[model samples]
Target: MNNFRFLVDPVFSKRFGIAPFIGPKRFRPPALNINDLPDDLDTILISHNHMDHLDYPSVKQLNKRYGERLTWFCGRGTRQWFLDNHVKNVIELDWWEEYHFSKKEVNIAFCPAQHWSRRTAFDTNKSLWGGFAVWDTTHKFYFAGDTGYTHNISIFRQIGKKYGPFNLSAIPIGVYEPRYMMETQHVSPDEAVQIHIDVQSKKSIGIHWGTWALANEYFMEPPEKLSQAVKNNQLHPSSFIVVKHGEIVDLP
Candidate 1:
């Protein structure tokens, strides 16, 4: 099986730019400028239509550079946005649907997440929003795009029982604030730990923190709180890691 590595979110460089908000350090997202990515990248899986995850400029930049070399897999709601922006090679799927990249031995399936979607006021939930489960011959990876604590976690665990025991999971652990307001959509660090345990993943990496000031918590609170939660739960530190921007950690 081929190895897996995440080139974390790449952001454009500029003051008050969108890059610094998603990752911990203040650096450009990553230099995947279309032409720089591996020729066999084969697929680009997007979690949702959020600015951080579905970056228009970055996607456009990649489209310009790669032409038809890459295929974009996004939510049903995001298809029109991409089409409006002139992005080709796009395949949109609904939750629970599966797409297979036969040549790569990769099977990507859309899964439910408790979240809303909107690019503009008129487009709320216009597109389906959710996370993804990427399974191949050697490994299973779960990318929880953006979500709140919901029964979806239990559903995902059932999915794991049938198709998982994920080798690695990339889950969000930020943007939660003012519990009452954020609780319905964004999960706190403690919730994230529950997700990690529920999914029964061998290793879990945190994301969606230190990026945008989407909530009331201080900039560094997600990781700090996440660490404390892990310790309190007596979970191994290596089981729940917080990666820095532009940093890559290999799955076990």
Candidate 2:
């Protein structure tokens, strides 16, 4: 399955900005470069419109190269970004909505994620923000795109009841230090572990960390914190994994 590629939130850049002082500068670069992408990429799942998630240049380049062969799925109101770029096959989905690809035998459902979206000041929260539940005959995976720990625990519980007990999940685990500022939008490591339980995932991996130091916490602190959180929650070492950049795992 080396040629089978599906990219999620692929941002390969030095900063999250469209113009000067628009967003924070990236502390590090993406592990995978856009040019390194496989020629026969299957699909692209975009979660939101943040510069880090919905990169304009990357999208433009991919569309220019792959065109209609690449299918783009994103949050409800995020369709315009790609349409404006002249992308041919863009699918926008609302929360709890499902899209089926019969040929690929895959189903993708948009799910609730407690977060906000904004690429510019006037467009704050104008677009939808959420996670995705992707499933096929053999695997069920949840991608909690970008979210915060909120009172809406039922959102995940509902996901668990509706489409979960997932085989694997990708949850955010960093850029959440100094809770006062980030509590409304980012989930901490402990909260990420809670999400794993909430979603009833058999195995999960910590993401949204290591690539960029966007918060006050030290760059190397997330993995250590994730380890402690798992231990404190009495979870097995393999239940929630911390993978190195560019590392490959053979999912069973």
Clashing pairs in 2: none
| Candidate 1 lDDT by residue in tens digits, 82-191 | 78888878889998999887767688888888888877667788888888888888788888888888853476576567556888888899889999999988899999
lDDT of 1 at 98: 95
Question: lDDT of each prediction vs. the true structure?
Answer: 0.76, 0.85
lDDT of 2 by residue, 54-134 (tens): 888778778888889999999988898788789979999999999987657788899988898987778899889999998
Q: Could you tell me the lDDT of residue 181 within candidate 2?
A: 94
Model 1: CA > 4 A from native:
1-36, 151-153
When summed lDDT is taken over every stretch of 10 residues in candidate 1, the lowest stretch is 8-17
What TM-score, over all chains together, does every model reach?
Answer: 0.87, 0.93
Model 2, residue 11: C-alpha shift (Å): 0.7
Model 2: CA > 4 A from native: 1-4, 19-25
Clash pairs for candidate 1: 10-29, 10-30, 11-29, 21-211, 21-212, 22-211, 77-127
lDDT of 2 at 96: 97
| Model 2's TM-score against the true structure | 0.93
